[model samples]
Target: MDKLLSIVIPSYNAEKFLDNVLGELVKCHNLNRLDIMVINDGSTDQTAEIGQKYQDSYPGSVRLISKENGGYGSTINTGIAQANGRYFKVVDADDWLDSKNLDRFVGLLKRTETDLILTPFWAFNDKNHHKHIPEIKPDDISWGQKYYLKEQGICPVPSMHTYTLRTKLLQENEIQLDEHAYYVDIEYILYPIPYVKTFEFVNIPLYNYRVNQDNQSISMTNMRKNQQQHSLVVDHVNSYIKEHADGLNPNQQELMVNRLSRMIATQLKIIDLAPIQMATKHELSSFYRKVKDKYYFEPKDINLPMRWLIKSRFNLFPVIHYLAILKMQLVHY
Candidate 1:
């Protein structure tokens, strides 16, 4: 029988959580419809062993792929190549799905023809034990109803963690993310925009996105260290939006604009957290000027430090970043 969904689990030294991840999935009523592919990306630990055990138990339903470490994007690239299911989803090794929502989500999958499926995801703060659902008002858009982004109202941008793209679309475009780099997830989400003609919103918060891990890509310290990789993705996305601007429909164009807005805001926060010397204010000024010149957002319109930073003509770079970091402490970038 053909599978409905290929849930790719990108694993690396994830043995601590791999069993729990598989254990929860195995409990799902629609397990038969799931192709659970665990990419053991150079796990020196027991991740491969545990994944093998599950594969042995579940046969084709669950499987493991071993490879040299090429980072998160490489594992996903491998999964896309191996997946045989109709729909594709990327689940981090440390993150797991909601078992109760599995059956209904799978049922939706069996009937969905939309190119993009957006669901809500929970940001589970590991240190604080607080859970946050990234807001997407499903009521604004009809469920299972196919529509172009312009005609329907979707909460501007959806997280990669909560989306499941059609396998055919990804493979057709040869969607390859930059391997061995952090922050490639944004590229994964934005690069596919031009190809996404139809979309569906599933209201369920199905993905449990574990947050606050010290070494996690989104962490402040990691983002500072991986700033080069971060810049790579930012530059790629900036150019991508420019290249596709006229090609996108009104709705698609708005969506892209909103997405870029959020992306720019996040980039500002990342820059704020970076250890830039006050003497090297030129670096911050140069970045600010380029982004401001690239997009036309009224500097005074939005209630963010970036707005003021944009308006200041780079003179306030040091003071602005100091203010931005204070807000970053409360919000997840």
Candidate 2:
């Protein structure tokens, strides 16, 4: 019953954050039941030193895995494969969880056997002190409630930052994240659906995602530069939907396609960002056409454009995308 939650912290040049994050984690009420794996991802900073210190201090609870730089997704893959606990979660180097919520979650862990655990996370910028728990409301999912993926009524899918999957289930499915990639977190959030049997929503805000960090992939500048990587994830997910929809039941297929639809919509919006070069714009146009054509086969609940206004490659895209963005902003699509 104890030693249930394994938190994988991927640290690459995070000397500034190791002490505070590890310090807070080790002070949790159920420290004995926690397995904290700190992956030193080829860090040239003092991260390894600090990780070793904690490993020595809490010999059984904390362990450090030193590996070459393989980017964030690889670190998660390594950590998941090596986790000693039953439930698994990935906490960023810069983010920390609430200590009280950690205790409460530990309590719930002792009671529930849900395959996927959804919880609220505080999304905020620490510098400005603005924070809010993103509400999962379609008037369906209640906090601290239990439901299956095939459950009736749609609920907002929780972000990877606030989810804990069963370590055994993940390992059984052989979930391999894309190496050296950004936006792989979305892949993690969605790829586990085929295996998940039950889910429980823990309403307490447990995760603190510190936004506005440097080198962040979410910024418009980085998104423009790494837009292809974003597209790579969308392609992988959409491919799964296209190939595997037949094996699932009706409820499972509906949930899977709708969740994937939102993801495609989001990536389409990302592709529509401004200041892109002509070459990349042309590539995006082709990519969009391919994805839209693929989705055309199973267009049950997908809410994309009836017709994209691409006269030629990269030629009417900017104006068309501006209109799409404007429409989305005004109509909440």
With candidate 2 superimposed using the best TM-score fit, by how many Å does residue 36's alpha carbon deviate from the native?
0.4
* Best by the TM-score measure: 1
Task: Tell how far residue 213 is off in model 1, in angstroms.
Answer: 2.1
lDDT by residue (tens digit), candidate 2, 1-333:
468999999999999988988998998989999999999999999999999999999988999899999989899999989987889999999889888889889888888889988788887765576777777544666777777666643444657877899999889888888889888897788677777878777777788888765467876568768877887877787777666676665555666667676666556556767555686476666666786677622334444352343334446567766775566434310
Q: Which RMSD values do the candidates have, in order?
A: 2.5, 3.9
Worst 10 residues of 1 by lDDT: 296-305
Give residue 5's error in model 1 in angstroms: 0.4
lDDT value, candidate 2, whole model: 0.77
Which pairs, if any, clash in model 1?
150-251
**What lDDT does the true structure give each of the candidates?**
0.80, 0.77
- Candidate 1 per-residue lDDT over residues 1-333, each given as its tens digit: 889999999998998899888998989898888999999999999999999999999996998999999998899999999998999999887888998898889988877799998888888987888898877655566655677765764546677887889998899988888899888888778777778888877777789888877778776677678877887777777777787887877666666667666666666666766565764466666776787787633343345666766667656667876776665567753
> Which lDDT value does model 1 have at 214?
74
Task: Give me the overall lDDT of model 1.
Answer: 0.80
TM-score, every prediction: 0.90, 0.86
